[model samples]
Target: MMESTSLYLSPTIFFPNYQNMLNSFKIYMYTPPNPLSFSSPTESLFFSSLRTSPFVTQNPEEAHLFFVPFSSNLSTRSIARFVRDLKLDFPYWNRTLGADHFYASCAGLGYESDRSLVELKKNSVQISCFPAPEGKFVPHKDITLPPLERVTHASHAPGNRTARYLGFARYNGVKESNLLNELRNDSDFLIESQPSDGMTLVGRLGSSGFCLFEYGADISGIGEALRFGCVPVVITDRPMQDLPLIDVIRWQKIAVFVGSSGGVKEVKRALDRTCKDDECEGLRRLGVAASQHFVWNEMPQPYDSFHMLMYQLWLRRHSIRYARREFV
Candidate 1:
């Protein structure tokens, strides 16, 4: 776990504003009737964090934002039901039509039921693991959250740059990528057809200069590769896939991005070009630093995954609405 006092861990630009966010931003968390709604391990941690967070306000009138405690697997019907209950039981939902409300969803915004919840989905911001622009996500309005897995491995410092493999890539699910197939012959790349059920690739990942992780429903691989200091080479057509802290991080400095249109040769070419560059070392060094954001701690750190997500929420702080007339 990263210590909150580490001045050197976070990116230089994260400061001042990071401090500002902690100082002024206030979020009011609604106690949903279903306390069991926060399902995942990460979601449970986040919910617990909010309960003890200094940012949480007892008074909704003073809050800059509101939180829906449920995590992922949220359907429009379920959310609609929850909001309907809120509208009936409280004044906040009806006041601004939930414009200031938000919730986290690990399952991307592609749920068919999402379309059915017209009034609520339109106004409420979704901090989703999957942010497909074609789906429910409204660009800049919603945030792309990387799956926040609890990392137990000690943080490895980036030092020597003597990785044996040029790159590493894998074929996920049933269909093998044409790009991966071409690279299997290349000794420089460790291309595997096996499913990533475990961290079998971690050993190779430590020695690889770049990890070309194709974006899929299972996005955990991206974070796993990043944890070991491998520069992530994300291949995806989705506009904002595999991105967190999109507004702040200069991700181009830390990873290689090849579009879905790019072939294995193109991927190899990009890796080859990056491998030769002097900046590649810097990117590798930054990859170690950037990986810190994917980690979660029992105690929240300064710019850890928790703080970073909070910062994103702070950036997307919607219009403040104090509905209760007497309180206003």
Candidate 2:
């Protein structure tokens, strides 16, 4: 008789939009819209506990394993950041790190609309981590955008229209803009300063740090305004899919995503579009479904508990463990 051997599984191919894919998963787990609390015991477990059987005395191994795993070592917020960032490695991780395994991370509530998560879930293959209290720094570094400054050049200006884009970066697909020219021409369009006297905010911002830009509003503040029923507008060269908004916010409804070519006119166009769209009116009709689905409130969701289940699944399916190994 000959002995048989099996090869360990290879890693999954990485995708550029891996984060987007994961966002979809997070959206799914968050769907049907339920309130989440970072402090909830069931939410933290990510898996149902094995209860004692009537006659069986043996401890159940099933409860010890799950498809997604939560962290005992990190808080829900930290874990949430970890998963959001790890999306870049999805393809590689999916195949080799282990099979049929997932991790549920968590992050602070009130960062963005959880409803956005639901939208993503309906379309992608990723998952959201656990939930946490609102207001904390994400585990990953903030995406840097050009700082707003008074333009001295002639090309950076436009008449009465300020050209503003947040989180602009060449690598991330933002086109190089002539800020000076835009400012010079748009004298009527002032770059809204961070402490704007009366301007409205438009996007999510990183927590616990001095803001990167000098004017207008931070991303978080923008999301806050949206929650309060104020429509927000964001300018970017890349897709808003990665931002705190996206599927949940509805492009022309409640918010706007401005592309590089879209200038002040674009903002107005977005605003105009938002006012006419009737799709979102039904959001109010969903009742608690609309309110709870994918919307994060003061409380966090069951992200961590879900991640723990993933971790357990990885261990059992692949004979691996999380965070117990080290190299000297």
Candidate 3:
């Protein structure tokens, strides 16, 4: 484990009104999970990260950010009801209009059709796995979370690699994509929509020189590929925002991006152009370097998913000037 570095928060930016807010940065977790409902692995990991962090405080008065850990998998009405109750109990929501609050979800699909929830979400920060389509995800306010997947074994070292070309385990959203058909027809391409088991998927990614990610904003596959030192080939129709930790990680050095409009020929050209042994090795090393940023640790570590999420919040918090408001 790498030693955690001391994080410096500028007093001027972090606490414009309150001088004590700099080193005393605090986060208050609202609404504990029900034993019956249970949190997903990602959600569980996030909560675990918060529990281990030194910044979490039981007192809401000292908090810099209020975390609503409600699962987005629930109905929008359920989430809205929770938010309504929160507002009734605390003055924080009304004061900032939800700007200082945040919630995490695997995807923002639940609140899309709900007008009330949509309006509320626009004011709050949404940390999500898949970037919502237009009118849904506000890039500057919301965060794109890297999908968290556990790696049981250390990735194999780069050497005389046997795997060649690109591969994919699933093809749900991109079935109609011409690139999918093109890669399938090409004799040199190795693509799989279904693997025999989890290990088989890992094996395919581990051996493959490049892994195909066809769906837009899906980082789960990208996470797995990076873990195994396989370079990711992202093919998307939508605008790809900077992958998580864009401020620190150079994604272009580790992955290939191909526009979906370019069709199969373009994708094939990219694969043919970049899958050379030397290029693959360089991508492998860069991927290894960037992989640490995506990991979710039981204890909050430097640049781990937890700290990265906090860092995103830190950036947003520094940008906004919070006025000193007295709450009774």
Candidate 4:
């Protein structure tokens, strides 16, 4: 429902170089999702590397999309709290996750699948992001952002801070080899094997086998590594997990389980039990199966031709999906 304040368009609209123009597309980011908190940098760097194709529109109303502010869930007074604690900011955000606001403009097209876009029993889209062409943002090569420095110390130590698990939320049990080497070099801690390259699972073992809670993937992955599997020797909180594909799997089963407050000895003991148990193998197999859901090539970006098609489809329906553009 928010309106745009800018009446002018950028010169990129008329530029001959499609890539330059696409990169110049002015996007109004409302609340940026925390790159440190997310499972991987895919969401953060994905858009920055986008290069618009010839088919994509350049107008602010068409090319520029506004991310819904992460403020809808909190009170106006708590806006600062949400922004500070969650590391989110909605300086010029135009859309929200609300279906009503995006039904007409195609602004919310990438959001979770709904009746307005498609008919699905349950909301198929959990998270929404920009779409782009392949090789638009190559990991390690084009990724230039500095590592997050805020999550260095836990309130409690599990004996080692050098080792970690990586994965997006829910999709668990993946680890990278480089991470293990980083942790092994640390003299302060004993070496532990990291999981395969992905998110590790964490959960409570009960009569039903595993009762997983809604914890972040990063936390769960580390717990899983310490508690059960070790695909790596050292642990570093590196960008490991990408956005997940399937929705059925519980994150706890694949993640490494850890307590919020516990001594290193306790963590060691739990790891001993998990490493020696037969259940861990079954969990590992499940994790391998679950991993098939994510295909890195499928992520969206600003350059992909598919994005343009989706926009045109939405436009035909005659909807108000976007807000006007502004630079500041």
Candidate 5:
């Protein structure tokens, strides 16, 4: 089925000032005193997107926010050191004490609450993929990046499928437990530890009514299922807010998240509820619509991942005080 545009799911519904944000929102990007290596694909995308967008401002005095771009895999202490150098070299850091600064990182952050980096971690806004402290990242202060590869289009549509459920990818740690031992003999489930000769991974996802995922374990799989128009039945202990733009996107509409602590029967019950009630069609449509939010474009499109990130930055513009300079 072809999916219709969902106006209610649009970010503008919550952020009515998006147009004004385009006109006025200005970010001052700090060129590091030393060269930085952007090792991860996620960091490279964010670095390029911010530079190409109109939100960047050359003049720091009039800027609403400051962006301090860094590379992946850097120790949190290294980041704090980088911030320390900025404080000595630039006047802006002293005025706000890095309160108005932000960075996008794929590296895990907030694990170490080092005394020196406390200001940067607690005061500055962190946009991260592996946001720490488990289940939910702190909102109104931080944004979780959609961990994804670059995609230009979404063309998949929901259709008749052969399997009731498909486990199309390997779990992060397979030794933890064998999934659905009770259904090992069942044909309705196409569960595999890895790909077999029957069909391609993408093919399996497309032909299945629902996909299973262990959220926070293999999050990229969630992106894949959405792109394929398969209603994702996620088994996770994580909060719904752990997802990108969950406050506005209504992830519950597109996906079902079951707690991992629940036994095998719980998984069967959830899947039965979705398929037997005839809700997969609507769920698939909304899941397809949500695919747009996980995509990264060179130039941000409305409600795309980059644009959604900008909305988060816009919401956090007031976290720090921007003071005016005075001359005697």
Candidate 6:
């Protein structure tokens, strides 16, 4: 698909102010906003990444995918107006019923606020961080984006490896409180329940062999762990539905998966089997390799998050065939 890959972004949605809206988060955070804490950087990263891809085309006729790059903060009425105008001005939306079109949003709360937006969800690829099953997130059609943090190659620090087995930072979810209590009592693990700064959290993740990933929270922690070469021990009841880059990364090869029930026992078993010197080294290698897929570069790189998202759209495009329409 890369040979002839092309995308046309709707001009109405890709306005000058749209870029300013995406970059606005940087004005307040000083640094890139943590993908784990807020949606702003995630939105901005995806926008900037796509903007630099070679596949982006000004001529709509050569395009395979049509992007509607709208922010989550846009009013539902404004979104509706854009769609209405696109349908009137361009034949692409009507020709494909928006199946060839897609949009990304990081604000889960904003999407849930407007019911009228459901029509858009039904038709286009809704790339989002929250892939809640009940929220009209069709797993087969939609894409789950990884919460990306701005990291240079030097972000990960080397130390004497003072920390041990596993670390759970800032975990206060009531549903998993029992498991947290169990792990806290165990001497093998480090559990931090209180709020902490970003550097502290990154240091904790870097030092530990494994990091706990709680379900229903920002899965960007998983990305952070991967970045630091820490194996992620996922705690979830269901299968990992929202894992980013699932299309490219074989998650089981690099990370541990455990059920919510018998959480301590499961985590302990995973750690015992995988945290040995040889096995830990292998997982670390895999994590470092997989980390390349999660990063966003100013210019699209091979196997980076931008190209991976494009690859996802390419896969979706091949799933169904559309008859070519001759424009009069």
lDDT of 3 at 174: 40
Look at candidate 5 and give me any clashing residue pairs: none
Question: Candidate 3, which segments miss by more than 4 Å at Cα?
Answer: 1-24, 32-39, 109-119, 131-135, 156-158, 166-176, 197-199, 217-219, 272-280, 319-328
| Worst 10 contiguous positions by lDDT, candidate 3 | 1-10
Please report how far candidate 2 places residue 19 from its true position, in Å. 26
Candidate 2, 1-328: lDDT as tens digits: 1111111011132222333223322111111112333333333432232111111113223222123233434544544444444335333222323222333333322333332232222222232332122232232211111111121122111123222432221111223245423532543333433432222222211110011111122343332332222233455554333332122223333344555365545544554454455532322122112112223312323322222222222223332322322223
Model 3: lDDT of residue 295: 78
Residue 327 alpha-carbon offset, candidate 5, angstroms: 28
In the range 6-112, model 1's lDDT, one tens digit per residue, is: 32334454687789899999988887756455445666777777778899999988888888765455555676677767778777776776777887765544444
Candidates by lDDT, descending order:
1, 5, 3, 6, 4, 2
The regions of model 2 sitting more than 4 angstroms off are: 1-99, 103-191, 196-218, 243-253, 276-328
Reference-based lDDT, each prediction: 0.69, 0.29, 0.66, 0.29, 0.68, 0.63
* lDDT by residue (tens digit), candidate 6, 34-96: 222224676677777666555666667666777775556666677776776676777777776
Error of 5 at 179 (Å): 3.3
Clashing pairs in 3: none
Q: Is candidate 4 or candidate 5 better by TM-score?
A: 5
In candidate 5, position 308 carries an lDDT of 72
Question: How does candidate 1 score on lDDT?
Answer: 0.69
Q: Where does the lowest 10-residue lDDT sum fall in candidate 2?
A: 1-10
Q: In each prediction, how many residue pairs overlap at the backbone (N, C-alpha, C within less than 3 A)?
A: 0, 68, 0, 48, 0, 0
Q: Quote each prediction's TM-score.
A: 0.82, 0.32, 0.76, 0.29, 0.81, 0.74
Better of 3 and 5 by lDDT: 5
Q: Which has the greatest lDDT?
A: 1
RMSD of 4: 18.3
